[model samples]
Target chain A: MSGGSGTRNTNTEPWGSFDDHLIQGSGAAVIDMENMDDTSGSSFEDMGEMHQRMKEEEEVTAEAAATDDDTHDDGEFLGMKGLKGQLGRQVADEVWQAGKRQASRAFNLYANIDILRPYFDVEPVQVRSRLIESLIPVRMINFPQKIAGELYGPLMLVFTLVAILLHGMKTSDTVIREGTLMGTAIGTCFGYWLGVSSFIYFLAYLVNAQITMLQMLSLLGYGLFGHCVVLLITYNIHFHFLFYVLWLLIGGLSTLRMVAALLSRTVGQTPRLLLCGTLSLLHMLFLLYLHFNYHKIVEGLLDSLDGPHMAPMQRVARDVAELTLNASVRSLGVTLRAQ
Target chain B: PDWFHWTRTSFTEASRPFAGLSDVSISEDIPVEGDISVPVGSSRRDEEFSTLDEPVKETILRDLRAVGNKFIHVLYPKRSSALLRDWDLWGPLLLCVTLALLLQGGAADNDDQGGPQFAEVFVIVWFGSIIITLNSKLLGGTISFFQSLCVLGYCIMPLTVAMIVCRLVLLGSSGTVSFAVRLIVVTASFGWSTFASTAFLADSQPPNRKALVVYPVFLFYFVIGWMVLTFSPSQ
Candidate 1:
């Protein structure tokens, strides 16, 4: 569009003089010269002379208006207004450009990292550092970074403890007291680690993506599934082994989806946080149900054994009682016969 | 010369007669019960048993008392006196007996027709270990349920070794070199159990007394039932 047309569109508003000055301050000189060239039948050789004359005339008009108190008021007011508008537009453009650059850089860096290769010839390290630098300005002001750092060590310890306990329970020949103790230890550790890690990761990811903190927390709250899986594995390895594999697969897929979602920028923070939260909650509920039911089922089995089938403990107790009764009867018989 | 000879002869003659008379009296006074009495003699005096003053008698009595005291002390030391002061030795003895009986009962049930049921035997061993460990801590004057549990879990090392020994004894060698192979397998299995238990206890959170006991017991029963139902031979 022509500068004059742009100015005219902006001028129809209350700030017409301001818009005119802004148009003039921007690259309006080129437009003015071209317009003059079209109106005056000037040869290319005379364009420089024509431009000088136009500059002198414009300056004279500005000075004359500045000198005359009555004429200066309107002119000076419009000029200052135009200068302010022009400065605002320039600032806005710069900010918009910077934001675009950052978003693009983030997109590229994440995409490259997720796929396990560089998308361009740029060094992965350089790209990562730049992306981090860009993110730092935004992220350093947020809570997620602090929370993640705070949680990292505790989560590591918890996971390590859980792993150790799980290994112990699985290997223990005594599947009763000792086994259960080990299993519960494992579950507690797993639950604590999962809870902490999920919270941190959700917070970090959501905050980085500019989502609500509460939503992130809620999403992380769903990590109860991982805890339940840990409990299940402790109690019933046969069932839990399968469940564990499935969980790992799901976790991996979810991580991939999160990375993809963040990179794509198709869904903003709110929807992304909600999606992750819902998925996590569903998984957790399923896991909780499995664990709770598994415990019940085991209890039922014990009950069944106690009912008529005779658990080993019961059988031994019953046998001892029977033997005692028999011996007493025999002693009574012997005494009666003697009598 | 004749007078001096007579005096010497009289002295010799009188001493000989006295000695002869004393010997004869000593012989006469010897009791059939094997007691011998020293005879009163013209040449010497005999002291009564109560009036006797021998250096050896007091020394002997003192030595005997000292030796007897030392022997008693060795059998029951001063440190054990503290144990004894709290309760009579019979109390601990009875506790130990009760523990043994419970273990025996569990073990008896574990004996299968073919061989010892390893799972059942393991459970019994685990329980016995826990009871012994808890009693040990209690005797030490600490009532930490979690610490007892952890210690019991860790002490499964000894029980595991015992299990292996039992296995080797019950399941004799089959073919050539079978004995050595069985021993090795048993040893390895025991070692693994020991390591596993140690590692598990090491990782367990320090016990919170209120929650540790009941929850753990409930969990144990459930887990045991589940494991048995899932992995038992009958199942």
Candidate 2:
């Protein structure tokens, strides 16, 4: 095909001006032999290129084997530049060095499978154990070692909690839109997660506490397992008195989990106490928000967040609703006893 | 001539039930063009020009037609990205604003009443679409960012309709029958929105992780549908 094209090219006259490349026109037979020689020369070049690539591959494998021995010692950030060979070199003070190390670590960690694996590679057993450990509320001694922080479990928990709350709210006689409620529930969960985590992280930074933002996020995410339990219990239990009891018991437990998670990272007694109290108050406020909003207990409290104050009659109506709810429970118990 | 042919065919297709006859007429019309070729000569002369040379009114009208075509596509979703390729945000914006306005009216009756504010609904719709689009991108979806957003936003039309229906139902009476009616509307629209979005987006997603992309899309529409379902005018 090339020889035919070469002959055609030599025979054909230029469509436009012929002054530009008149010297290059040659006999078709000579051009065809040159094309064959060029093809043979290219084959030799290909062989050389293949040999070079094989040599490069061997070097890469040798380097990999060398790095394999130091895997445990250097950890995942072994190849990171600023972190390695910093024994004697001092570009700046320790604080600056620390920042540099962090920056380098951050810069180095792009599309890294190892760094992202823990967030997504969650097992059911890992999640179950984390939830069980979260149920304990506080673990001062082996706190860091106990529950592994993961994103997948926490993300699923958020979605599951949203679904459950939406279903639970819909089944009940709430006047609020479930679609908007779902959005709000999602906003509340994620907004609460991100907002509270950042707040605690900020507080921890203020107190010179030792914790990373991811660590704080992971801890708080696991803490949501307890919140799910509390919401689930309050959702199912159905009696107002039992609701409050479960709310206090389980909600308080979840609050303690958050508090302890944050508290353990703080250095001093004062910071610990402050974080504990603040986290507890925040968790309790969230519980109150969830109860009033989801349980159809009082639209007044939910409304008062962004809506106008309850009318005088509306407050009375709320009271009446509460009384009716209790009365229905009593009548149900009596009917059951008679049966 | 190509542009004229495209517009003519599109116009014919737009007119329901006449599509087959118009297609047959198109084949016949070309031979007729050969006989009396004045318009064909003019079009051939202008063939080198692009849409940039088109009049502003024509451009706007064409875009409007495109938006309307997308709405029709959403109304009767099919597994074809042909309509979605010419993506626009106008339809989504209109639907988002209408839905938000409906929600704002229901929640914000009193000035002091802090309910689902207009801005809140606006943010949720836009922000949720963006987040879902970002998720699709992260999951190796072949679709562009705005294309995903356009699909997600355009799909909200059903939920917005459901919202309107719910608002109307709430107006007549806030009774069990009304609640049931709203539930049915919201659920149907939710399914429609999900189905329509997936129809458009499923082809662009990685085959193995298609569900990962669809899940967020489902949740986004579901949240909007839930908002529509649960809306009660704060008295």
Candidate 3:
């Protein structure tokens, strides 16, 4: 009981007014940047200047709203010059804001997984919501913030790598020395992420999707988070095909969700559809490869990534034995069986 | 016009409470405190807001000198965030002892393999923690190295429970029933440890670095969870 009382109580919570401060900070920064831009500006002016302008505009807008009674439109930005550029700037600004939250959600979202499905459905603000943490990564026209998502992707890679490393370590104590086992597992985890991310990036680029390479890396990283779950559990458990399949199904769904979230709406609808469809099939194949070729691939990677353990003479001698002595032994056994 | 419609949907939901007000009236709702219309955004200076200014307690406890107190802290992580600082190793040490004891029971090798199995598991867990610590450091995380280990080591509590269940299943069940027990226990613990540890490590990373650190910590636990699931007493 005393131990309960002993926990170091903090005077201030770790995060104080963090959410509000972040919003305020971002607004200030956005306004500053917008005002500074000669063109491609997202908002109107300097803080002091903007406040005065807003006050004047508020009266004009109030009168307009009352007279026109058009709830959605009390147009002012529209009547100003260069409408296309203005719209582009606005979209760029909103996307910047939405992406920050999206990126965080991509990482922290599943830490509360009892109701992943319902969580996405409940926050129906954008198409981004529909795809995040969901199984279907349908190509939407937006992406989340990059830096956290970028770092988060690497974390997933590390998770997958750690899973493979520990699995190898688990076997080393159980079975043979497997000197190269850890190295191979490490290489495989790294290679899988790099290869898959590159492949997806290529697909996205082919379709002219607004998906960035960094976002793709994050998606791959997060996608592998689910796979790491699958590998950690299944690889350790013995030969339970059903359990493996079920975990794969769930992991695939999440990966698909990331794929959808990564695809920018700038992508043509046709190629975006093709890319998602292709990636889905590719993911299934990848799972099958993991399942069926698990041992074979590990062994091959061990040989490749493990570097040279045996001396060249030792390898040559073994090859000679297989060619001459083993062949002779096989023939003798066949002849004896015939007799 | 097309772009306006898109932005409207994306942002309008948050602005809905003001929809009924005229534009001038809505602007008038800007909160005032002292001389300024403060840029608090969603924050309000309401008296009912819970204050976090409590008496600060040092996470390190003098009671940690006693092994019993250490064990108690191990069982109850929040009782003392000793792991949050450098004052205790008991939490990880006790968790390991309990884990080894649990794993030792119903083990296939039983007595001879007991010490080795426990050592292997302990080493793997600690080593995995180091991987995460290093990754966080690489990403410019602010959490102290030992603090990372403490969060990771304490997270073993859930997996230890799973190990206890494994020992129980070994004692009382066989065949299909045994497999079912193992699966359920490991999965639940896997979920708990992954989520719990993430909560601790989540804020430590520069928000940019979370993907790198959090994901690996998650995978490391997954590996531990797998060991618990696959464990069977030797024939």
Using TM-score, give the best candidate's number.
2
Which of the two candidates, 1 or 3, achieves a greater TM-score against the reference?
A: 3
Least well predicted 10-residue stretch by lDDT in candidate 2 chain A: A33-42
The sequence of per-residue lDDT tens digits that candidate 3 reaches over residues A1-339 is 111111111212322223423444533211111111122111212233344434545555565454454323424646664578656755665576457545544553222231232311211122223224445555554654231233334444455655665563454233312223344455666777778778878977877766667666656665665555565555444335544575567776775676556544335667867777766676666655554455555545545654778322111121121222222144564565577
Each model's TM-score? Answer: 0.21, 0.54, 0.42
Q: Give the TM-score of candidate 1.
A: 0.21
lDDT score, candidate 3: 0.53
* Highest lDDT scorer: 2
Compared with the true structure, what per-residue lDDT tens digits does model 2 show for residues B46-94?
5676788789999899888888888999999988775555667898898
Better of 1 and 3 by DockQ: 3
lDDT, each prediction: 0.36, 0.62, 0.53
Q: Cα deviation of B161 in candidate 3 (Å)?
A: 7.2
Clashes of each: 0, 13, 11
RMSD in Å for all candidates: 44.1, 18.3, 17.2
Each model's TM-score for chain A is 0.24, 0.55, 0.44
- CAPRI-style class, candidate 3: incorrect
